[model samples]
Target chain A: MSGPAATEAAPAVERWTPLSRISVVAAVAIIAALAFGPLVLNPDWVDKLTTLFIYVILAVMWNALAGYGGLVSIGQPAFFGLGAYAAVRLADAGVNVYLSLVAAALLVGLAARPISAFMLRLKAGEFAIGMWVVAELAHLLVNLDGLVQGETGTSLIAMTAYGAESRRAAVYWLALAAMAVLVGVVFVLLRSRTGAAIQAIRDDEDAAAAVGVRVLATKRLIFILAAAGTAMAGALWLATAISFQPKTYFGVQWTAYMIFMVLVGGLGTFEGPLLGAVIFFTIEAWFGGSGVWYLVGLGATALLFSLFLPRGIWGAVESRFPLRLLPVGYRLRGAPKSL
Target chain B: MTSNDDGAILAASGIHKRFDALVVLDGVDFAMRADEAIGVVGPNGAGKTTFLSVLVGAHQPSSGRVRFRGDDVTRLPAAERCRLGLARTHQVPRAFGGMTVFENIFVAAANGGGFSRGEAYDRCIDAISLCSMMSVANRRAETLGLLDRKRLELARALATNPVVLLLDEIGGGLSDGEAGELVETIGELRRRRIAIVWIEHIVHILLQVAERLICMDAGKVIADGSPTAVMSDRAVIDAYFGEGAA
Candidate 1:
């Protein structure tokens, strides 16, 4: 009889997940600011940091799509532009400025349903290039006059409607709250069955399908979810800037900057984007004047990350500690083996 | 004499398949009775695997209808076929490399076998037990050896609780002793009343479990009879044994 199984020791995984540690700190820090930052930091600096939080949200959205879904899209500006437009239009029509951003975000993400039907027909590389073309078309149409004042753009005129500085500060807080919620939603989804299926698809599609996963539906859902969340980020961005131009609203550099952060920090791991975002802001502060060189260096770094460390920095870190901080799966360690 | 009328669980009549210009299955007809065990054998490029593909809904035949329990299901997707109690393994094992062995079995049990999570977890243990692989359940599939891999492939398929199982070369790369053990396990499956169409080159193992044997050549059934009679038939000998003469 195989007496008590000769137990080979189980592989050691993570003691604590990077996902939990990072997100806890991030959320607590943001909430702490809402509770106490007004007492310590200068209001001007707080306002600037709030704007940066919007960028963090954008990077998180792109990371969810590319790092997790294996979709490298260079044209997220289409949703961002539409979202801002939706926010401004609804506000012009008497909706609350804050409500407009939320509505706009949801609408832009939902509007992509018909578009995804067309986009899904394209293969991997073609689909990416197609998004670029679509973004350009969307930008052109919005600038064609009679829609949100076309080329002249639209302005909220905060001074005329209410006290300008206070409204601006309130909007900053609103933007901060939006980023926190979006990040939480994405992280939760990533740790669910849907997240597991997407991760499996990222590794290999045919294998995922053989296990009874619905590949297309999962991808489409995430794509739309990311798009909508990104749209909200765009609305808040415009709200903070207090000005919207077709060129500025539809800038490709927004996607470029977010991709750089995602690649530098990590793709699949949660903390990578935040880490990358901080690194980016630091570099921009140091090398403020070397404009094109900043672009060149950023591009080069992304290339290196893609070619050499395809898993990203956090991926490298996690390999040493295989235990997932976000332990979404309920594991069943079968009965103790009898060797 | 080979007709089955006890509510043919899966029936394929006048099925033909072609890959581009190369004709593969030429008007082949096959059927699985409620609990019959049949083995298919053929030379290379003889459409044996192709027949399984058509039956499992992995590929569409150029022509001919497929019926499951008397209802036409010729154009269903592979996963849907699995949901309807049809399961198959590849000629080469197709285990998901990134997944754990237990996770793989869990998928087969839940998604294909129509079991709940608790039930899937239960069946996964049973599947691992059947393959004698409880020791390596937590290991990644890419780390498994060839013999264990062959065992895993059948165990996963069996985990699907398939009423009509299509196995392609299940015994191809196994050791003789392991193959003997597998033949006994498959014999156990036969006794449990699972219809099987096992395609393999290992004649003796198939002979031990299959009540009927089919020889396919040029996408058509060349010989169909009792295992000994089919093996002894001159055409079967000429096509299979003739290769050794060359």
Candidate 2:
């Protein structure tokens, strides 16, 4: 039989808050260096660091949809490819490059409205797989037309129009800026009342809905927001490479990389995905073209970590020593008030 | 609390519900004054749970009108009903298993009652203290045992700040002392004048609390009156207490 309910003593009931002590300071310092590392590095390494920054933004978007919304999507490449295609098309049509990039991201968000209607019909595993199929089909459909030059793909002449050095530097800074904005947006969202609703629904949707949460609409909004961010990351990737192919832009490898980063870093918390992305990028840069063995190594590492530290590295660290790197959501116990 | 009985806080007329032609509530009609602590006593399959579900918008009556505070709310969704101050517990406490004990209550206060974070926290803490589940507030609902889970369930409903609270067997799984403590807490609620409709199999407990008692069977109320009179009514004695319940 269940005992009398456990009444908390005031101290134990006090809400947990993370302190930005040495650990957080160290992590942030490291991240800052990583983002700007391209500026201080040899010219050869600039493109790679910029790529890592894009990965940071992409991981955050994926984590937001899966970790926070409980909608684990394996088809984020759909948005990524859409963003690239939009940018390439706009640059082709003689539009200003920057405006095209922004429009490209927005278009992905808008398009997600209808896509979600169909995808949301499936739940959990089915939904995740459905998104993957959507991405693959999108890639196939887009490749069939000469719009993006089919399988041969098309060279993005904008980087040439802008020249090599400035283009490289611009892409690097833009990726950094995008990651920062995505992180900031996530922090703001986590702090809002809506964030609490999202977290609640993620934990127990039926209970959340019973308590007046609009589970479907809220999730749809997150879907669009996260997709838009991912699309922007994809667009930036294409610009950095100055090219796009159906296979490359919509590659399932990007999905694999995103999932690995999130799972390794910490799926739910802010800064975890960023940290994970940095770690994965480091691993990739060091061992990238050493063949498929590199990927196998990363997967093996993830399997061990997932088995041992299911919450991911940052999740474990956060529990032992709280660091309020991203302070969102309310802490209720310190003060007493009349309702 | 101010009495607002004339406002007809809850009304049900011809509330018919069926489960594939096995009629549950056969034209059940009932009404409650504001802050009235009414009791619903019934044997198994009597539609008492179904009746409460209709009141709380969890189920729709086949042909009936349900008005709350003189406003028609038969078609409103469950969340809207919760926002409008109608809340209920499950017969078997369906606490959110994945959420923390505190979070379960917080959702109801914030989403169900439209309370601000500070306001919702206060109400949630208050409800937790009343139900006495605060110690496990940080613990996942999945980890809670039967009695504590029931407390969590009560905490959730109470956090909604309902004007008309519908409880479905909160005392069912509890021990005598636990039930007695809950009764005392509920008695305090009664003094504060919150309208309550408690459905239970425990006759004496509701008799000790509710001013009026109802007995339902086959989806219809067979008896409704003061506790003592209804407890002794021929049909109630036969169906509920039988000859040995005297």
Candidate 3:
């Protein structure tokens, strides 16, 4: 035993294990299958998939902000509105509709930088409501402008040039790609040194500062990044419908759905949001058109998940199974030769 | 490493701290030499923890200058001060409840101490072992017992590789056996030549590790000298066991 132990140090287990490998393989297979969806699926299914992608993006971004960064925000729709408006205004100004979608995301992300300086001042519960107030203000401000027709709504005239089939495919593919990029960015980020600093701040701001984390700076960065992601989803959403309405973009319902998805899936884990988004999409697709009962059903499901599964479905599953598809923490194995 | 020529590692003069109308530390002047462990004791609300907070930059002094290695750092943030080799443990243990015990120390080593990845990993492991918390290093801090939490607090501070460490009430809730173990850990740190200023109510435990004792009362240091002498001082006994105890 001593000879083997001396010959090689205890096996250092990294975050990536055999289980993670399997999870990754499964995820890649699913993504590849989804990529071919528009080719085989009916137009209605493709449209539903696009909506699912948007929800997934929104849920993941919200989780990163509130669950990991400890900045609960109810104002995500503010950035979403900005992205939608930017996309519409840019397209109206004769920019390529697809290019405008990308530009809108960038602009909203840049805009969040300055807003963060003010918004991040509020803590926890106050921060959540403060964000909602900001969104309402943004909604009011956007209505004052005439280019957006003052809440009369506007369509993506540039995209009208494409055939219905082509437009649907473009929106589906872009939405899927955007979701993949956002998830990939968040996944890589949480596995980095900066991610560690951000999580430290989440645990205790004072303790994090004591350990040399630039608290304000880290919070600001996360806020802006999450805004960019939510904005991107909003922009893609505008492309999907080819119409821009301030009320829909800035509505509190958008944020409510994001919260519900993250809460019912898992608040902090990467897999939780994904799982939550899928479950939410399936339920909506099956019963969404049932109107009042659909809303009631969604509410009841969320309440049940919260009451019995506070960690959400993914969290509960993780606690029971101890599986991590996107592990971001370190794990050591085998005892050292001596203390 | 200090440029004071007198080998003073940390110096604070005319330190005053106030929260609204309440004055916690009143015109306190304190300094420490290299590798010296000073024990600070006081009656309840004597500003012992407040003074430690001031030294570590957790609480900015109302009016005073804190100099570390001859450079004025009164305006520097706590995080900056920690990175500059001034570190402290809280009176109430503050652990990152969501993270494992090792991650808490790792954050200190990598972020506060500015160690690289490999060095931070090694330092975290060493700190856990030093604190005799290797068995629970992988456990979440929230799940640890009180003694383990205190050990984690010390390990977190130690991982920062401070030249001067301020510890507040680290021995407050420990049993005799656990306190002895903690004392041995602190003794090893003392042998390593790290300057320490410990604020603890347990006089005997403080005396076992600290070379000198300073007693405070109502925001003033009434006595400062050798442990045995300070403990027997008229003013110190009066502050602790009442006016007639001396």
Candidate 4:
């Protein structure tokens, strides 16, 4: 308050950290390796990794909505179910399964605009439950469709056109591509002006509004984007499993998994969901055969994380180290040396 | 009704706010010219904060109109009002805990001022420098002490490039030295020609920067005049103390 003594000579501010730079190169190498996963790894591992990619997509989108936007939606399965059903209907009409997956995801994203307008009116607990009601309603509506034969469900029979090895590789690559694109989208968004508004809204809605942040608009954007990303993951899951059951697609259990992964990984950090998805995939691959016990173990781990490491695994690590794999924050440093 | 032709930058008339029969504000009417610094003093429950809220569009009045620069902004949400150059700081600092101080100010510059990235960066730097917050610009806002938090709140509002800044008890709990520093910063803002409506309990510090004063009692303006004249008014004295004592 004395004067501008300290800021008279302002130092430069940069966004990239040392670890973030290394992360970029490492990420490229890892993604390149994963691209050839079907050829290098066994078909079963390929299938598992594909499922892991889907988990990453769902976890990242959920984190964006709940962690960044402060919109804790327990009804993301609404769009997920809609996407699966859209893909199924398209496939049944003789469209290519892969094209149906992409188209269905876009269609669901569009559908989310109106849904978000209504859903965003509810806050906190009401918003959470309102989304669940929407998912349940979507499930019932899909049941009424003739293409969806009630509880018995239907398969993406068009997928039979591809050979087993070809299908597995294609689905793996599609899931990987979707995961990469969606994660990139979220990353760039958080680095943008709108991303700051979203985080501000999450921190304090009234204060954010007082500061001129368009709270409802920012929340609505995140809601629609999360819906689209979740739908893509759902469509990819259908590709891998080749089944379209409204009960399965619209089940509340999907949202439960998303919450578990995000909470266990890190709620708000960019790298948290990725770490969480990897840990979740490892657990599911190892103990998923244990049935109800697997679910119980997941619940317990989530509880432990929430109780002790409330910031999640990546959050705990970030607190200890000056590392950021996906840095969306700014850091001040000395002026750069002249070239 | 106050017309915009008279050169009032912000004006509120017939503001009646009630919460289930509890009238917080009763037909309060006020106006401020461009670049004028007005201090508001009142006893407890005088609805000073609610008045600021109504002006900033944070709360809707039961039956009233608020005009900002000739536009009817009564129905506008707080964010839209802010983007139109109406910004405020809370009595209790509401810094975004998860963001760094610089990020907090930058958000106000970008979103509130609707500036481009480069412009926002420059505006944020200017605000931080003016508020003497450059030392903790990169610190997490949640980690700041009370004085720093208050400075951040002021800096955030300044970053919005507001035509009128509504400050709610920003100097309330500060030490004498800290409050003096804030007054200096606010005085600098006055020189820059940003109109300020500061509500403060510390009348001496309020008098330092404010040429005009308005005293409220029971949600009505009991006195409004020059700082010394308003302070000496019988109504203000009676409201602050008691009728017989005054």
Clashes of each: 5, 5, 0, 0
Candidates sorted by TM-score, best first: 4, 3, 2, 1
What would the per-residue lDDT of candidate 2 be over residues B1-246, giving only the tens digit for each residue? 113324688888889988787788898888898867889997888899899888877788888878887788999877888888888888776776545677778878988889997788788888878887655766667788899988887788888888888888989977889989999988877776778899988867877789989889778889998988888889976776574556
Predictions' DockQ, in order = 0.30, 0.31, 0.45, 0.53
- Candidate 4 displacement at residue A70 in angstroms: 1.3
- Writing each residue's lDDT as its tens digit, candidate 3 over B224-245 gives 8899999899898888888745
Best candidate, DockQ-wise?
A: 4
Better of 2 and 3 by DockQ: 3
- Give the runs in model 4 whose Cα sits over 4 Å from its true position: A1-9, A334-339, B2-5, B244-246
TM-scores of the models, in the order given:
0.85, 0.86, 0.94, 0.96
User: Which wins on TM-score, candidate 2 or candidate 4?
Assistant: 4
Model 2, residue A221: what's the lDDT? 81
B39-128 in candidate 1: lDDT tens per residue?
A: 899898889999888988778989988888777889877777777788888887777665567666766776667787567666777777
lDDT of 2 by residue, A251-303 (tens): 88888888889989988766688789989988987899888998788788778
Better of 2 and 3 by lDDT: 3
lDDT string for model 4 (B23-97, tens) is: 999988898899799999999899999999999999999988998998889999999999999999999899999
Q: List the residue pairs that clash in candidate 1.
A: A5-A338, A5-A339, A13-A323, A14-A323, A17-A325
Better of 2 and 4 by DockQ: 4
Per-residue error (Å), model 4, residue B183: 0.6
lDDT leaderboard ranking: 4, 3, 2, 1
Error of 4 at B189 (Å): 0.5
- Cα lDDT for residue A278, model 1? 78
- Candidate 4, residues A1-339: lDDT per residue as tens digits? 324443455656678877788898898788889999988999988998999999999999999999888899999999888988989988899888899999999999999999988999898999999999999999999999888878889989999899999999999999999998999899999999999899899888999999899898899899999999999998998998898888999998898799899999998888999999998888887898998888888888889988999879988998787777888876544322211
